[model samples]
Target chain A: MASDRTASQPESSRGYAPASGPESERGAGPRAGSVQCTSRAAPAIGAPGHQAGAGPALHDLDQATIVARAQNGDVSAFEWLLSAHEGGVFRLALRMLGDRAEAEDIVQETFIAARRSLPDLAAPQSFIPWLYRVATNKCFNLLRSRRRHPAHPDAFDDGSVPAGSHDAFAWGEADPRHQGDTCGGLCQDPALRYEAEAQMRALTGLLQAVPAGPRACWLLRDVHEFSYTEIATIVHLPESTVRGRIARARRILAEGMQSWR
Target chain B: MAMNGGKPRLGCGRLIDDVWASIDQPATIHERSCRDCQSARAALDHLEAVTRSMRERDRGDAAQRPSSRVREAIMAVARAEVRRSRRVPLATTPLGTIDISEQALNDLIRFAASTLPGVRARRCTVLRSPTPQSSPGGPSSAGVVDGGDVRITLTVALSSQVRIPATMTLLRERVGTIVQAQTAITMQQIDIGVEDLYDA
Candidate 1:
C-alpha cells in the first residue's frame, strides 16, 4: 500500500529532476551555484586557522602542506590531521550507527586506512570528502551486516536508536550544564527544557523509521551541512538521487511529526 | 495540487513539495504571494528547527570526542605501518642482513639536531652509499650496501638570536656523533640548511 501510494505521487513531489532543471542539478562541484541550505558555523574540517592546540609552526601550515608532509611519512603531521578530524568522523559514525563503541571503532579504522593510502591521494583538497567517504562506507557496511544478523535487538534494522533508549531521549537532561549552544536562555527554564527534550526524543524516534540510505542523505544535508554536491560525492550517488532520497526522508519525518505542530 | 493526508491546505493549490522546497530555497513568484505556501512553510520550519537543535546537541556532547586510547592506537598503527614500508640497510652478513627504518634514522637525526639551543629540525634525508658494482647511470638507492657510508641533509628552523656559523658547526658535530653512535656507520658528510627563522 505504501509503495503504491508513493508511486502515485507526482514526480516533482518525489524530487525527481524536471525536464530541464538548473545547471547545478547536473552534479557539479560546490562551485556550481547550488543553494546550500545550512550555514557552516563550525570551523571547516581540514581548513587552516582552526588548529587550536597544534604547534605554532604546524598551526601556520595549510591543509595541503600538512597532507603533503603526512604523505612523505611525517608522523607528527599525521597526528595533527587525526586530532583535527577525529571528532567529526566519530560524530558522523555515531549518527549513522547509533552505537557509540561501533562508531569509535569506525573512526579508528578509517584513519588507519587513510594513513595507509595517504601517499596515493592525488589531490590534497579532496582529503576531507575522501575521509568522510571512507567513514560513511564503513557505516554502510556495518548497517548491511546488521541486516544479515540481528545482534542488537534495540537497534533498528537501519541501526538507529530504539524508542526506549534513555540515552536517545535524554538530550541535555543528564547534564543540564551541557545544554547545547542553540537553545540559549530558552532552555534555562526547566519547563521549556523538558518540553524541548521531549520533542527531540519524539523526533528522533520518528527518524528511526527512515531507511538507512535516505537517512544518511538527510543527516549529511541537514545536520552536517554538507552541500548536495559533497553529499553525492561522499555517498557515491548521483546528485538527483541524493535530492530524491533527502526529499523522501523529509516527507516521512514531517508526516510523522505532524502532532508536534 | 494533490494532498496526501486529510490536513487542510489553507487556500492555495500548490503541492506540499513546492512548499518544502521553498523553505530551503528562494520562493517562486507564485509561492511568494500564496498563503498556503506560507502556512506550509511555517509548519515545515519546525522540522528544520529540531534538526538544527539536534546538531547542536551532538556537537556539545563531551562523549563525541574519541578517547585518548583510540588516538594512541591509531598513531601506533600508523607509525608501525610507515616504518615497515621504509627500512634502510644498516649492515649485511653472509647469513642475512640488518636493516633500520629510514624513519628511525630521521627521528635520530632530528632528535640530535633539536638538542642544540636554538634549532628545530624540520626534515632529515639520509643518502646511503651505492654498492661497489652498481651502475653509475642508474638511480642511486638508499640501503643497498652493508656498513656503507651515509650522507645526511638536515633542514632546520633557527631562532633569531642564534649565530648561523656556530649553530651549523655544533649541529653537524652533534648529528654526526649521534648517527655514528646509534648506527655504527661513518657519516660521509653532514649538511645543515637553516630553512626558517623564529623569534627567540
Candidate 2:
C-alpha cells in the first residue's frame, strides 16, 4: 500500500516530511523539488515574538505580574524567555556536544523537557541552570550514541573533526593564502577553526577522564561560572559534595590538560 | 582520589579546595607560600587556563562555519519543542514573568519549587503575546500594555500524597518568598491554581 505511494512520488523528493507521515494512501501529492529539508524555522504562527495568543516578555514586566499571567497558561511569556536565551543555550549545547547538529538536537530536547516539566519550576527567574542541565543531559545522550556508531569526519577545509584524533592534520594543513579570500566564508577561517577543533578535543579528553557527577559540577561552577549552591541544586548533589567534586575535577583538569597545551 | 566521603572537615584543605573551584579566584596565601602546594596549584592553574582558552577559541571558530545545517538543526529542535509542549496537556503550565533568560528562569523556578515541601509539579513562564505589537511608540512606549501586561506564573500540582489546600497555601507563601528574595519582583499574586489533589 505504502509502496504504491512511493512509486507515484518522484525519486528526487525523498526526505523528512514524507517519511514522517503515518503510512497512508494519500501520499501522492506532487513532490516539491530539492526543497532544502534543513530549514528548521517554525512557521511564524502567532506572531514574531508571541505564540498561541500569548503575550511577549510580559514575564519581565513585573515579577509578580508576569508570574500571575504565566500561571494562567500564557505561552507568549514563555516564548519571550525562549527567544532571549536561545543563543546562549545553543552555545552551551554546541560546546557540550562538540558537534553542531547534535548540539542543535540537545537544544531542542532541553526546551521540550523544560516545557514538559515547566510547571514543576518554582521560580521563573532562575531557569538558566535547569535548562542547561537538561541540555547537558540531552547532549551527553547523543554523544553516547555517536560514540557507539562513529562516522567519517566532516571535510571542512578549516579543520574541524567529527572525531578528535584527526584534528592536528586538519589544523596544520589549512592554507593561509586562501584564508584572506575566504575570510567570511564558513570553511575559510583556518586559525579560528584550528582552535575550535583543538579546544573541543581538549574538552572531550578532560571530560572523559573526570567522573560524571564531578564533570557537570565543575563545568557549571568553573567554566560556566555557576555558584556552588547553584551547581548543587542543578546536579542534585549536596552543596559540600558539589564543592568537593568541583575541586577534584579542577585538580584533574589541571593535571590532565597541562600535557595538551 | 575522591575525598573521604565522611562529613567534610573545615581546615586548610577545605579552604584550598573552595579557592580552587573558581579559576578567577587568586591562590590563597597559604597556597602561595608552601612550595609543594604552590607547585601543584601552578600546574592546575596552567592546565585550567589552556583548556578554558581552547574552548573559548573553539566557540568563536565554530560561529564562522558555513553549515546552515547546524542552524537548521537548532531550529528543528526549537520547533519540535514548541510543538510538543503545545500537544502535551501536562506540559502546559503558567510560569510568571521573569526578566531573566528562559533557561535561567526555568532553573530558578525548578530549584525554588523543588526545595519547598509538598509541591509536586510546577512550570515557570513569562506572560507574552503571540504577536508582540509595539505600543504606539516603539520599545520606549511599549509597557505592559504593548505585551498584554507582563506576568510570570508558576502553576503547581501538589504531591498526590499530600493535602492539596494546605500544600497550595504553603507553596504560595514559600514560592512568593523565594521569588521576592531571589529576584527583584514584588509578585502581583501567586495564583496557586491547584491542578490535582492526591488522596493519602
TM-score of every candidate relative to the true structure: 0.60, 0.44
* Model 2's DockQ score: 0.05
Score residue A167 of candidate 2 by CA lDDT. Answer: 11
Stretch of 10 with least lDDT, candidate 1 chain B: B1-10
Docking class of 1: incorrect
Fnat per model, in the order given?
Answer: 0.19, 0.09
Error of 1 at B37 (Å): 2.8
Q: What is candidate 1's local distance difference test score?
A: 0.61
The best candidate in terms of DockQ: 1
iRMSD value for model 2: 22.0
Model 2 chain B worst lDDT window (10 residues): B84-93
Deviating ranges (above 4 Å) for candidate 2: A1-76, A91-99, A139-204, B1-3, B6-29, B51-200
> Compared with the true structure, what per-residue lDDT tens digits does model 2 show for residues A1-261?
000011110101111111121211111111211111111111112212432222222321322223323443334445554554455567655555456676666656665566567667765435566776676677556655655665822221112212322211111211333222211123356885565456446656656555445666666655555666666677666787776666555555655544433
Error of 1 at A1 (Å): 34
Per-model RMSD to reference: 13.8, 22.4
Please report the TM-score between candidate 1 and the true structure. Answer: 0.60
